[model samples]
Target: MEAVMSLLVGCFFAAGVYLMLSKAIIRILIGIVLFGNAVNLLIFTAGRITREAPPVIAPDMDRLTGIAANPLPQALILTAIVISFSFFAFLLVLALRTYQELGSDNTVQMRVAEPEGDTLPPLGY
Candidate 1:
């Protein structure tokens, strides 16, 4: 199972990077989402995959006696999910606004700040 998850994580990272390299804003957004998921999975896998009991101890026991699933990765992944969602939302809104203002989502065409035919600045001050 760990091997499978590792493979999947690798695939996700690859796809995310591939998509991020595209010129389209939407593709980049998707890539970011994928990348976030990949990171979460990586954290989860690093925590060790096991079928042990939950990380809880009985009141009568002095401490946990057997192997228990690690809770840190789960907590981290949950927090990361929320953060990534908000980040993705913000980026989506920003992309929409840029599209509205420029009427294009392609980075190559969205060049209002630096129009073509402008004289190049002096090579040296």
Candidate 2:
């Protein structure tokens, strides 16, 4: 199971990178989302999946007796998910605004600072 999950995570990362390298803004946003998901899955797999009991100790016992699921990774992943979601939303809005103003999502065509056919600025100090 772990092996299969690891393979899936690798594939997600590869696909995310491929999408991110594209010139389209939408693809970049999607790639960012996919990469975030891949990271979450990677963290989950690293936490070690087990069929053991939850991480709780009996009232009488001072420490957990048998196996207990690690809680740190789950917490971290949850936090990452929330943060990623908020960031993705912000990026999406920004992309939409850019598209509205520029009428294009291509990185090359959105070069307002350096319009096509313009002479290069001087580089002297």
Candidate 3:
């Protein structure tokens, strides 16, 4: 199972990078999402997948007796999910605004600071 999951994570990362390298803004956005999911899955796999009991102890016991599921990774993944979602949302909005204003979604064509056919500015020391 771990091996399968590892392979899946690798594939996600590969696909994400491939998409991110595209000139299209939409593909980059999707790549970012896939990258975020890959990270989350990586965290989960590192936490050790099992059917063990939850991380908790009886009132009488001071420490956990048996192998219990780790909660740290779960918590971290949850936080990451929320953060990634908000970041994606912000990027989507920004991309939409850029597309609306520039009428293009290609990074190469969305040149605002240094447009084509313009003379290069002089370099200052």
Which candidate has the top score in TM-score?
A: 2
CA error at residue 51 for candidate 1, angstroms: 0.7
lDDT of 3: 0.96
Q: How many residue pairs clash in each candidate?
A: 0, 0, 0
TM-scores of the candidates in the order shown = 0.91, 0.91, 0.90
Q: Which tens-of-lDDT digit does each residue in 1-125 have in candidate 3? A: 99999999999999999999999999999999999999999999998889989988899999999989889999999999999999999999999999999999999998898899999888886
lDDT of 1 at 91: 100
- Candidate 3 similarity to native, TM-score: 0.90
Q: Which stretches of candidate 3 lie over 4 Å from their true place?
A: 117-125
Model 1 residue 24 CA deviation (Å) reads 0.5
Q: Least lDDT summed over 10 consecutive residues: which range in candidate 3? A: 116-125
Better of 1 and 3 by TM-score: 1
Model 1 misplacement above 4 A: 117-125
lDDT of each candidate versus the true structure: 0.97, 0.96, 0.96
RMSD of 2: 2.1
- Name the 10 consecutive residues with the lowest summed lDDT in model 2: 48-57
Which lDDT tens digits does candidate 1 get at residues 1-125? 99999999999999999999999999999999999999999999999988989989899998999989999999999999999999999999999999999999999998877888798779997
- Looking at model 1, residue 93 earns an lDDT score of 100
